[model samples]
Target: MNQYLLNGKLTAKPGHQEALAAILFQASKLVATAKGCRLYVIGKDKADSHSVYVTEIWDSKEDHDNSLKVEGVRELITQAMPLLDGPPAKGQELEIIGGTEI
Candidate 1:
């Protein structure tokens, strides 16, 4: 199977996790239902409440590339950026694993 992975963390203002939660929930649903989306997950840092991480995968590189152009995905990121206290650091990755969930 073809796959894609991404990781990012954002620093949000205190008491704003709830707000971020709403956006994340909506974004997550949009992403999870998107064409070729195999998996998508967002996780908050246990040690730092302001930090978050997402891991995602698609059925193929074409599907993955197309996902970047999805309007819902673009809107989600746009809506989320203002909530951050700092620039988000992100990295894209290809699958190379024992095949267990991350």
Candidate 2:
């Protein structure tokens, strides 16, 4: 199957990286049981202290989009808004050709 992959970056306001990471971590929990969710890994950017990255894999792009409807997701998004340095940049969408089991 051709899986959907997204690499998203979020830049927190000064001193809010931990807070933003916390919110995203909470979101990871909320989506843990979401349909088609395979992997959702959070990472910190070594060069940019304010940046956090979320890498996700889903069965399909539709499944990824539908994840937004999962319970508490919207709320988490709302909670994350003010912590951002500015509007988030679009996530990088990747076409998965091959990979080891997730």
Number of the top lDDT candidate: 2
The lDDT, on a scale of 0 to 1, for candidate 2 is 0.94
Worst 10 residues of 2 by lDDT: 93-102
lDDT of 1 by residue, 4-79 (tens): 6655556677767667767877777876767778777777877887666666677766776777676687887788
Residue 99 displacement (Å), model 2: 1.9
Cα lDDT of model 2 by residue, 1-102, tens digit: 699999999999999999999999999998879999999989997889999999999999999999999989999999999999999999999978896976
Report the error of model 1 at residue 93, Å. Answer: 1.8
> What lDDT would each prediction earn against the true structure?
0.70, 0.94
TM-score of each: 0.75, 0.96
TM-score of 1: 0.75
